[model samples]
Target chain A: MLSIRDLVTSYGNIEALRGISLDAAEGEVTCLLGPNGAGKTTTLFTIAGILTAKSGAVVLNGEDMTRLRAAEVVSRGIALVPENRLVFPRMDVEDNLRAGAYSRRASAAEIAADVADMYRRFPRLEERKDQLAGTLSGGEQQMLAIARGLMARPRILLMDEPSIGLAPMIVAEIFDIIRELNREGVTILLVEQNARMALDVAHKFYLIEGGRITFSGSPGEIEQDEVIQRAYLGSRQG
Target chain B: MIDFIQNTVDGVMFGSSYALLAIGFTIVFGVMRRLNLAFGASIMLGAYMGTWLHVHYQVHVLVVAVTTVACTVLVGIYVERLCFHAVRRDAALASMVSSFVIWMQLEEAAIHLLPERTYAFPGLFAAGSYEAGPFLFRTEQTAMLLLAAVMVGALHLLLHRTRFGLALRATSENPLAAAYMGIHRTWTVLCAFVLMSLAGGVAGFAILATDQQITPFFGLWATFKGLIAMMLGGMGSLPGAILGGLLLGVVEAHALWYLGAEYRDLSAFLLLFAMLVSRPGGLLGQRILSREELAFRRV
Candidate 1:
């Protein structure tokens, strides 16, 4: 379980996340749906400790992780699949996956086994194991990014905009992967602009607007809300 | 023909030291994407420490070499902490300017410690020349060449076959993503500085030991030569650095022989200018991809 309480993060004078709080329960997918510039990515970054918070706390289970750096955050079992699927462009797919497990103190044999598991999970990666990650197709790169995050063996995975630029079919496939990951008992905190797809897999969803959580509800409750219908579903007939 | 071949041979032997120096610069540049102008000054200070030890305490050549490398690493850490670590990452110009100021400070510090225009640097090997098949090789230059090769081989292994090297390369490729992978950016950059400083110290020793002398101008000379070599070979490529150094050395040697010493530097710069016009990427440097091209590749 992860609890974020009144987290405030800023960039100079502009506050990107102004006292926003949310939670992702254990073994569940919690989706944050927001428009562009709605502090979606900023919230994920602040939770991953890539951006330091101005105030409040990020408690994973119970321990305070508010002041930890990104490296420490990963070591504490929170791995972020950053927006844009920012895989190491020049490195081969295998090395990129190897880099994913860098924070763990696992032995070579153990790490190799985990890498093998990734290869089995995503066969396309194994096929292009020796190819530079940048050369992979957009869909393949997204898979590699997910596999890389999974390589960290985190207690919770935070994925930001994994389907942002992918094809429609690939977006569906990515959501399927997300559902499978959750089914396998990995907790997930996902940020998405695709409310429809995210709502299908997410156990609970929160709608964020202008750096604040405007709505939070079950998938059924969300479907009946007029604001969700007009703003997210693009339907005025709600 | 014999004269040309002889100059080339001499150039190559001397160029090994240049290659070592270029490697130092390239490694730091590769990791940080910022220039540390104080690289040469740090090496100069380290060499000054060695020369002081030799002059006052009459230490062994081995002791001087160790002192030089250790001191260079210390000065390098100081520069990293003050100029690089203190500055904002996005303000690369600030880091460069800070390093430039540190270079002046380091050079002045070295001069204050020695207060001499020139001092003798202890040679690693006895003064002698070997004649083989009508070619002459100085003992120190030969040693430099051999050591440079060994160092390059060792460094290649360290970069390719080690976990630390992987982390370093990842950091160089993408600092933010590397952080997501839990690679400590500051620690990795510090390690890179220390690694390059070790190489720079050895390079400074080799060059000084071969010349058997040191002066305040050596810092400027080392910086320019290393910078030019790095640029010539391609900025960040390791092999490019080595190739550039050898090419610069050979060209300078021929110039010194044919056009006189005045044209030596001129010829080297001219080659760099021509290379820039013809192929701006250098002999082995890859053309950097534009953001659009990179995005296109992903799709």
Candidate 2:
């Protein structure tokens, strides 16, 4: 389980997240949805310890991880699949997966086995295992990024905008992977711009806008709500 | 034909040291994306430290080289932590300023310590030239060449085989991406600095052995020759730098033998300029990272 309490984050003078609080239950797909500049990525960055919060407590599995550095946060079993799938450009696909396990305490053999497992789950990656990660198609790179996060063997996976720039079919494929990942017992907290798809995959949903969460509820309950309709779909019923 | 052959041999031997200097320069530039103008000063510092060790303590030449390199690494790391890291966030001006400040400080310090005086560390090889047909090869030059080859070979192994070396290469390609993957940014930069300083220390010994001098200003040619080679080779490519250093040496040697010794500098410059015009990226220089890979976004 992960708990973010009264988190406030700012980039210089611009407040991206203002005193927001949320929880991501274990093995559940919790998706945070918001329009552009909704502090969604900021929330993820704060939790991953890439961006520091001005004031808040980030409790992951009952430990305070608010002030930990990104690498240290990773060592503590939290891996971030950053937005845009920032895989190393010049590195081979296999090497990128290895980098995912960078902060792990596993043996090389164990890591290799885990990689083999990933290759099994994502056969496309296996097909292009020796190819440069940068040259992979956008969808493939996104898959590689998630697989890389899985390699870290993190207790909780934080994915930011994995479907941001992909085609609809590719986006569906990504969401399906997220669905499968959740079913197979990975605790996921995904930030997404695609409201309908994110709601379909996530168990719990949080609506964020202008650096604060306006609503949080079960996907079914929130989807029926008027504010949810307006906030996400920009209700323009004639 | 005999004169050409003799100059080629001499150039090949002398170019070894220049190649080492280029490797050091290119390694730092590749990783940090900053030019270390003071790096020459680092060489000067290593030379002074090694020579001081030999002159005062009568330490073995190997020990002098090792300890001086270690000292330079510490200096490099200290500079990284206190100086470079702070401004690292700025990207454009910080590292350049960091290198500039260190260069100025080292220049002042070197002046205070040695004051342009050239003192030699005792040569590792006996003083004699062995005859090859009618051409005589100096023993010290041959030894220096062997040492240069060893440094280059050792670096090749380190960069290709070791985890530390891979990490350095990755950092050079992209620092932010490396950080997200848990590669310590400071460690990568420090490793680069240390590698260059090792080059510095070896250069000190090479200069001392090859020539009979150790002055504060001794490394200017090393910097110029090495940089020119990197420019010719392509800034980011290792193999290119090696080839470029050899090319520079060959051109200079020919000029010294046939075109008159006064044209040595001119010949080297001509070669470098030709490379710049013909292959602007050097032989192996990597262009800037792509926007998609870096995940570029406008603010």
Candidate 3:
């Protein structure tokens, strides 16, 4: 559903993503694995239009959407559940969901219905519908953030670090939710520092390091290569 | 005893207008983490429209106030567009002069229109004053107090109960994050500015109703009180602004009554200085920008 070619992004003097190119097929999970400062979030931000690209093209379903603003990109059916679960911290859970659905022109009744469906799926969110998002637990906040993104009604959902700093149980739960979401046919572009967990679920994976894509292949091929393993794991141990 | 009570009531009533102005001023500062100097002018513009409508159309006083408030909101939107929007990336104090320039322009226009003659606004409150010792309360003063309360309540309810209000509150805390949530950065800010300007306009009308005398400087007095209130209340906290205004008003009123009127402005300024020295974070303001928030935007 999404394709990128020669995408170069910079922040001031430093180059974040140096001439990177990748593609995600329709309705398939594409995971980007990287260590810190490896340009994982930068790629997502560039594609989501939060950061401007110095040069390159982001083609979504054959149409170039590289130049669109974040809000415009959302209207084109792209939503990013950003790093750090940057949920609208001060807004109520329900309002956060409403904010997610902001890009589309949904009627009040329709919005209510979508919100109800979201609440039904994520009951924790429904329970805390009126509470400030900032006060929610890290896991709950992450779930709320994802649920809020879903409210955007995007075709391709880009998630950055869905498992960072989360407990083992919560991380498992989040991955299960992602798997269920994918099974139900929502295309996902998940950026994970949790490489072992990412490799387990992702159909195809791309490894990024030092602002460049050094490898792109299936999980089996990536796990087989000693050099690829070193680049991904950073220590070929285990 | 009666004089003391009356003075306190007067102070509280006067404080209400100051509170509204302070709230408006602090709100923009809190959100963008920058002082919106043109804010005072935005209020004056609103006030001018309100009184102008009254002078021209012979509309009801309450209606005039509403019209004035609405006009200020438009001014707020315009100021946001022409002033704050462009200076976001420039020096922090780049827009400070924008307000002074607006103030001068407004002063010039008012002088031209009034034409070297002092003009008195029509007093809408039916006149009657209750007296006790050195303090007094006129029907107009009472009316001003009641109406100010109603305005504050309405403003508070709008902010707490509405979805747009929550978005606004969120914007005040973090504009960048608000944008990520699909809230239009410019629109949300414009909404806040409009609301603030409306408050300023209503304040002008309310003061005018009390026969407080409408010079070009009426706006300046209200703006000064607002700045003091912002310092007292901890910028951007709703309840805090009200308390600060009321406290400053009473302090000034007391000074006016006891220490003679010469001490009124000086007293208020000194009080604000004391408050600032004691609690630099402001009465309820936390996480405020220490240096200019706009300048901290090296990113």
Return the top candidate by TM-score: 1
Per residue, candidate 2 scores C-alpha lDDT tens digits across B1-299 of: 88888888889888877777788788988887777766677777767777777777888867876766776666656656655676755674767777778877876776776654667666766678999898879888888788888888899899865567757877876776666667788777877888887875676567667775677776566668778987888786788778887878888889998879899999998887887777767777765457875676442
RMSD, candidate 2, Å: 3.7
CA lDDT, every prediction? 0.91, 0.82, 0.80
DockQ of each: 0.80, 0.50, 0.43
What are the per-residue Cα lDDT tens digits for candidate 3 across A121-155? Answer: 89999999999998999999999889888988999
Chain B TM-scores per candidate, in order, are: 0.95, 0.87, 0.87
Off by over 4 Å in 1: A235-238, B1-6, B289-299
The local lDDT score (0 to 100) that residue A196 gets in candidate 2 is: 80
Candidate 1: C-alpha RMSD to true structure equals 2.9
Interface RMSD, in order shown: 0.6, 1.6, 2.2
lDDT of 1 at A194: 87
- Candidate 2 residue runs with Cα over 4 Å from true position: A230-238, B1-10, B57-59, B86-88, B128-142, B288-299
| Steric clash pairs (candidate 3) | B31-B172, B50-B68
- RMSD, every candidate, angstroms: 2.9, 3.7, 4.4
Ranking by lDDT: 1, 2, 3
TM-score order of candidates, best first? 1, 2, 3
| Span of ten consecutive residues with least summed lDDT in model 3 chain B | B111-120
